[model samples]
Target: MTDAQLSPLRAEVREFLRAEIDSGAFTPDVDSWMTGFDPTFSRRLGERGWLGMTMPTDYGGRGRTPVERFVVTEEMLAHGAPVAAHWIADRQMAPGILSNGTEQQRRRYIPGISAGTVYFAIGMSEPDAGSDLAGVRTRATDNGDSWTISGTKVWTTGAHIAHAMVLLARTDGTPDDRQQGLSQFVVDLPHPDIEIRPIRSIDGQAHFNEVVFHDAVVDSSALLGRRGHGWQQVMSELAFERSGPERYLSTLPLLRAWSDHLREHGATPNQRVTLGRLTAQAWALRQMSRQVARELSDGGKPDVFAAMVKDLGSTFEGDLVTAIRDASGIVPRREGGTHLERLLAQSVLHTPAFTLRGGTNEILRGIVARGLGIR
Candidate 1:
């Protein structure tokens, strides 16, 4: 896992991305993992055994190292390839299923996930709670052999197209119970009683959605992990979500665009200095992210470490956008602009979300403070 073994695979992925780009499959984009959803490309990766890069062969995964998977994802984000379709499922869902899913659940979901045929949406945030699980009011009423879910989930990315969702519900307690009485479920999508509506972001993307469960019923087998262990299960999954390269590399394609512009149009000395500073910060964030991945591979609960990476990485992402915007002096246009201008437009609009998803910067700081015994 620690060998320079990543080199060959990295080269292979780069070649594939090059070919895809050369063939005009997609335009390079900033934050492509979130905004550039192409299921066909995702299935292409699955065919190459790149989607579930770390799961075991038993689950139809490649059994590669987490660091190795990180290498692949890093390349994808850097290229601005369309990866949104499988990003959530491959990054968190696969690992979450492996960590807490039953054998039956694993058999049913993992193979499809690795094949990029199945997609999942995270049903964590609510209109009131945002990403705060403590404010959750979604209730799953137990109906003997079945559970009836009735509630609303907001900011649910890709719910409109997902096959299922990993959701938390209040199964046995009131709001005062906080962490207790919360349970997780794997509810299938497109059910008659379940409704989904898109929420357009400032960038005019409709990937996020509001999902309403109106007494949607699922069998007892829908439960994930232990009963009333939703908090623990979700916390475990965040280790994968918050520490990845996507946290920082969302703006890299834009930076690359800026770099291209500078190379073609020339830059002042100050602009060169700015580029150097940004690259330095990007490298530092990459190192911290890699360390978190290594710690996870070694079976350590690096929750605080992950929080630090996420917080800093998101800051870097925003900073990268600002630096590029100032240096390029290109008026952003969502449509009919030069390549750099268009990339700048998207990256500019996406900055607000950098510190919001995967837990806000405020929440991440709280995690670090508590984990470090900072009183």
Candidate 2:
């Protein structure tokens, strides 16, 4: 689709975000984007038909292309809206389910997801198996038509508020092999056998959780794709996860706010040079990320290039936050109700997680190096 086709939707979303900002639904002072979590905000976006624009129409989706969805997502992040509540479900689970789920699964789960009535958490990274996908030991035992699962998942974002979890586990681990017996399951978070405890970050936000699944029974319908396909499924999902604007743009509001502050205060010579450099870097990264999105929309696996974007984008994020703080020569306020103070505080706390989440920067660089035959 042409850029023109995406512009109108982008404008429409911008208007909606402006309205939300005007109504005091959220404060623009902080990275209003990442600091808040409101189900109502999500449901409002859903009601506007902006939540699941890429899914099919039958399951409460709008049947738009990835590019269309990209326009909506980019706009939401740029406005610094509190989209974390529905971000995972919209970005990864919905697409993964649609790609690998049965018709019944889709019919049962996706409509609520599209409507923003349902939420999901990812149960991938465990306490012992942070970056190692092949090391997950969550056990899913076969019990005729259903399965019983038991394990712990750490750093699970929104588990306390999520309706379900797209989990990875070992269904049939044998002594000879580990990857041979992997699977993905949709475990209901509110089930009696499950527990979710908030793991507050350094910023004093309980955005992450330690989730324990004990004998959580799921029917056969909960299985996604096929048995022993977790490796391929997780890889496919990461393509969508890593290639998005979220990687670099999560900190956009902070950068923009800093830029605005610099402009309003009359930029000095040093400030002018720093601003130009940061602007160029942000612009180039944005273009690179969009290219990866184009590849994803074309149904091509942009794994190698996507890894590059994630690695570089993460570095850019850490560096940007540091540079803005250093160049401005201003202490990030911790007490003010203004947007700049909140942005500074939130960035100081949340920026470290950027390199750790999705995939660690080290892992991403390894993939890129291998793809270049540099190993």
Candidate 2 — which pairs collide? 29-339, 33-80
What tens-digit string does per-residue lDDT give for candidate 1 at 1-375? Answer: 654878898999999999999999988999898878899999999999998888999999998888999989999999999999998999999899898999999999999899998999999999989867877999998888999999999989899989999998899888799999999999988899999999999977899999999899999899999888998888888989999999999999988888888898899998999999999999999999999989988888788899999999999999898887887678999899798888888888989999999999999999999999998
lDDT of 2 by residue, 279-342 (tens): 8998898888888778878888888888888888878888888888888877776677667867
lDDT of 2 at 261: 88
Q: Estimate each model's TM-score.
A: 0.98, 0.96
Model 1 ranges with Cα > 4 A deviation = none
- After superposing candidate 2, which stretches have Cα over 4 Å from the reference? 29-35, 174-178
In model 1, what are the clashing residue pairs, if there are any? Answer: none
In every candidate, how many clashes are there? Answer: 0, 2
What TM-score quantifies how close candidate 1 is to the native fold? Answer: 0.98
- Model 1 score (lDDT): 0.91
RMSD of 2: 1.7
